[model samples]
Target chain A: MKPYELTISQAHERLKQKELSAVELTRSVLDRIHAVENRVNAYITIDEKLALDQAEIADGLIARDNMTPLTGIPLAIKDLICTKGLRTTCASRILENFVPPYDATVIEKLKSAGTVIVGKVNMDEFAMGSSTENSGIKITHNPWDLTRSPGGSSGGSAAAVSADMCLGALGSDTGGSIRQPASHCGIVGLKPTYGRVSRYGLVAFASSLDQIGPLTRDVRDCAVMMNVISGHDAKDSTSVPKSVPNYLDFLNGDLKNTVVGIPREYQSARGLDSDVADAVTNAIQTIESMGARCVEVSLPHTEYAVAAYYVIAPSEASSNLARYDGVKYGFRDRDKSDLLDMYRSSRSKGFGPEVQRRILLGTFSLSSGYYDAYYRKASQVRTRIMEDFKQAFEKCDVLLSPVAPTPAFPIGENADDPLTIYLSDIFTISANLAGIPGLSVPCGFSSGGLPIGLQIMGPHFSEGQLLKTAWHFEQAIGIQDRKPEIGS
Target chain B: MKITPEEVIHVANLARLDLDEAVVEKVSHQMGAILEYIDKLNEVDTSHVQPTTHAIFLTNAFRDDLVHEHLERNQALCNAPQRDETCFLVPRIIG
Candidate 1:
């Protein structure tokens, strides 16, 4: 099998028998990336020499029997992450030349685990859109259907994994950035409990909502990657100090005692594609067959989530993204007079249209006069939505729903309509708002042959349980073995 | 609920951003539509709910103040578009 196509477990087994060296594995994946990356546009930067050099070091550690689970793995990182020497653009022209002086905590952990990073993947500028078409540099196409998007702000990472350019990739989820793309690209994407993973090196989108996660081909790989990337980091003040779990240990048992809730609010809604509805229904039936009981539940405040999210996210983004002034870091225009001109001209030349729109909305909402009406009211609504989730979880172990209202739409379908674009993130944004964990796994395909994803959401710090449920579901459905024709 | 092009341009200035007139008119109309949609929030009663600042229950996540390291000034300035003897160069103000 091609190195890029090997599951994390299979690759580990081959490494143990000395059947493959980290250098060889890394090279093979890089070779595949070279073959197809232009067509997929998965990477913003491919560090061929740097990856091989790191792989050689991993090979030496393995020779001494000092191997970590990720010792020889080659992974792609979303451009939103700060890599010390590489330009982390966040797919915006403003930060096009910005390079961090330090590695993010997650990057530090990945290096410690001996994982070799192949390159940085593309994304929507500042994680503001559903389709990667919002990316200032280029659009990352879906591997399954080239005319469709791979999903955004983690679109390039998802495309990289689906197109077999990398074994796995790291992504950041503000709303549905990870899950939406994973659904679109037909892969497993895990959004660990918000504080479960450190946010130190991630470029700020909405500080309260941004979280780094993994995008892989299967649940097991997502679990392994999570173990390595999660835990407390002093650099990220929001990180939790709780002991991390060996996620692989929890992938046991059918749901005999597990009570999975089917939120009637989700199924009763309009706008859901018929194909996605069917896939989610069939997935629940499969879980029922495995002894897990399904019960109807209500999240009465579901309607308020998206509304609260738009207000809160933009408000936070307005504050968090304030650091990008010309005087501090990132792109600055040369032709400008005085401080005001410098700030305006630099920002005008630097930010893309979508980013500018959000910044304006956020600033207006948070402004002195409007704060009471917009931002304040939204905060109150957020509390209600969180309470709704808390109440539902009391009756169930986890909640199951469709990841998105539909499968990936055609690439340029909603680009012109900003409101239509925001609606794409409706289903997944609530989790971020509630600071819970959610994972999207490919259950089946739409009638048009696009991938359909089933969403599994859990309470705070319930990532282990969520992954286990998703793992068992993946096993029962046996969908991981289904690869795209573009798959290696 | 309806925002005018003038309001969009005003907000853009307050945010220290520059938007072309065409973009301002376009975004103002779109934002007007969205805010009009969200006006439905006025009907829901949220008087009893305490505003949620964060979803997780944990609090007081602080780090020690001791400085561990510092970046070399030259390396920090490497990505600067224009630089001078001691700091970044910008258009002269007092002229």
Candidate 2:
């Protein structure tokens, strides 16, 4: 296998033995990126010199027998996370030239562990869209088929990992951003429980729903990355003061007493592709044959998730994104005569149409007359959705469903249709809504040969259990060993 | 509620976005359709349920009062589109 194709665990083993230096591994990944980046368009920035410099330092740590699992691993960061000198654009032109003065907490953690920072990946502008076509910077194409979207707003993260541009990438999940893309790109994407990972510098979309997690080629790599990024931080009040488990240790490979619940609402939802349904149904059967019990459960409020999410996410977005006015650090209209005009013109020109649409939707939802009708109603419905998950967990260990209603769709298929795109996140958004851990693992491919993903969701902080179950199922299916023909 | 072109422009102004009249018309139709679909929530009664702003229960998270190192003045201003040596430069606000 190519060095760039190595999982974090595999790379760690080779580096520890001195069989592969961090520089060689980083170079192989960068070479792979340099080879297909034009076609894949995964990264917004690739700082080769800085990446190699970090790899050299990682090599120094490895030689002294002092290292973390991620020590020599080259990982791509979603542009949302702040890196001291790197341009963290969040794939929006408003912040296109903006660079942070300090590292986000996760970046600080990764740097301290001696990992190589490859570059920033593309995302939907401000993480407001399901497809990366909403990216103000670049459109990240799926590795499986260049004509298709990789999924977003974590599209670049997923695309980079699938193409072996990087070993693993960090992605933020707000309404299936991470998992959906991972599904599309044929890799593993894990969205930890809300508050499980600190949202300190994760540029807020819906402050209540967003959580940062990893996208990797396999489940164990997900676990390895999870161990490094999950922890409590003082900077984020929402960071749960809870115990951080050694997630890798959960990969014991036994699903002996596990109960996987299949949500009926999801199984019978509108627009669910028959191929995706069959693949997920097969995944449940595979786990059952492996000694786990499969039971049908219902999350009655599932139909209302997208409706609630659209209102809640954007309303919060309107407030959180309020910081991007002309005055601060991002784009500013120098020609405007006054402050308000400057604010209006700068934002109008800096943001794309989808972003503008969302901001308007948000502003309307949160306006005084409509707040009770839209925003407050959405929040109340959100509570009921959380309650439904809580009730279902009483019957099962984890919920098994399709990550998306369908496999990766053609680019621009729903670009102009906001409602269709919003409905695409039906299955995965509930996990984000309820603040539960969710994972998207490659199950089977569509008749069109596009990869379909099985979404495994668990109760709050059940990441360890979720990863373990996905690991067992992955081992049985052995799909992670398969690679896209584009790079392979 | 039926969203109007005038409403779209109003919301855009509230959002600090100066949009074209055509874009506002497009958005008005789009947002109107979205709001009509989201009207699905009105079918469910949530009068008794408390609104949840966050998934997990958390309250004020305080930090130590001790002084800690922060970014230098120059580093803080590095990404500013228009900044003087001392601060960010914006259009006249107090005139």
Candidate 3:
């Protein structure tokens, strides 16, 4: 296999054996990026000189035998994560030229691990939409099928990894942003427990629901990344102070005592494509044959998840995104003569339609006479959703379900109907609402050849167990080697 | 309609977003549909439940008052759309 095609573990092995240098690997990936980027459009920015320089530094570290697993690895970052000196757009024109003054805590951690920073990738503008078509920058096509979306708002991150544009990527999940894209792109994506990873530098989409995690070609690579990026940070107070376990230790590939919960509600969920349901059924059988037990568990509040999420996410987003007013560090409307007019014009012109829609929805929900009915009601429903998970977890070690209701649809399939896109996230949004970790592993392919992902979720800080369960399933399936055909 | 164009305009003003007439019409329809869907929350009897603003229980984080290195004035002002040597310049707020 070419160097760009190697997973993080494989690249690490070759680098350790002196069979490859970090510089060569970085160069190979850069070349692959240049060759296929026109078709994939996975990246918003590419700083080759900076990436090569970091790889050179990695080579020195490797030569001294002082290196972590990620040392010398090339990784893509979701544009929302702050990388000092690199323009972090968040796929919104408002911050199109805004460069963060400092690295996010995760970026700092990755840099210390000696990973080469490839560049920022696109996302739905401010992470407001289910597809990257909301990106104010560029649309990232699915590597599996160019006409289909690489499900988003982490579309570019998934597309980058799936197309071999980068070894691994960091994508933040507010509501299935990471896992859904990984599902569509046929890779492994993890949304760690809400406080498992610090959000100090992630451009806030919805403060209480957002978490940063890894998207990689395999479960092991995801674990490798988790080891480096997970843990408490003084910078982000919401980050848990709990100690992080070495996630790699959990990937024993043994499923002998595991109990998997198959959500009864999920089986009968509306809009669940038959192809996806069949794939997940086969996945359950594969796990069951490996000496694991599967039980039917009911999360009765499942139907209300999208409703609660749409309200809560947009509410928090309205508050969190209020800082952009053309005054401090984003787009400005110079022609406006007054301050309020300037704020209005700058935001109106800077934000995309989806973003505007969300801001309006959030503002409406929080406005006087509406707060109790919308925001408060959603919060109450959120409490119910969390309780449902708590009760379900009492019966099973992990919950298994399809990541998305279906494989990736065509690019513009649900663009005009925001409500339709919101409904599609029903399967994955509950995890974010309940503050649990979720893993999406490639389960099978649709008859149309699009990928389907099986989501494995566990209680808060249960990433180790989730990773182990996913690893076992991956090993049994032996489909991680499949690659999208991005012709030369 | 669940929400009217006038309501959209009112909320847009509250959010400090300047939506033109066409966008106001479009957003009014879209927001109306979304709100109608969100109305599904009313189906649950949450009368006795405590609202959950955050998923995880967290206490307020306290830190020492000791001075620490922070963004330099230049770094802080670096990305400003309009800035002087030290301050971000904005449209006049005072008469």
* Candidate topping TM-score: 3
Q: Which residue runs of candidate 3 sit more than 4 Å off their true CA positions? A: none
- Model 3 residue A84 lDDT? 98
Off by over 4 Å in 1: none
Candidate achieving higher TM-score, 1 or 3: 3
Residue A105 of candidate 3: its Cα lDDT?
Answer: 96
Candidate 3 per-residue lDDT, tens place, A1-488, comes to 89999999999999999899999999999999999999999999999999999999999999999989999999999999999999999999999999999999999999999999999999999987778999999999999999999989999999999999999999999999999999999999999999999999999999999999999999999999999999999899999999999999998958888999999999999999999999999999999999889999999999999999999999999999899998888999999989889999999999999988888899898999999999999999999999999999999999999999999999999878999999999999999999999999999999998899999999999999999999988998896456999796
> TM-scores across all candidates?
0.98, 0.99, 0.99
Write candidate 2's Cα lDDT for A1-488 as tens digits. 88998888999999999999999999999899889999999999999999999999999999999999999899999999889888899899999888888888999999999999999999999888888999999888998999999999899999999998999999999999999999998899999999988887778888988999999989999999999899999989889999999998999969999999989898789999999989988988999999999899999999999999999998888888889986768888889979888888899889888888888888999998999999999999999999999999999999999999888989989867898899888988888888999999999999999998989999999999999999999999996445888944
Write out the backbone clash pairs for model 2: none
Error of 2 at B29 (Å): 0.4
Whichever of 2 and 3 has more DockQ, that candidate is: 3
The positional error of residue A3 in candidate 3, measured at the CA in angstroms, is 0.1
Instruction: Give one digit per residue, the lDDT tens place, for model 1 in B1-95.
Output: 99999888889888998777787778889899888766766766988778878787777876677877677888777777788656877678786
- Model 1 fnat value: 0.66
**Alpha-carbon DockQ of candidate 2:** 0.84
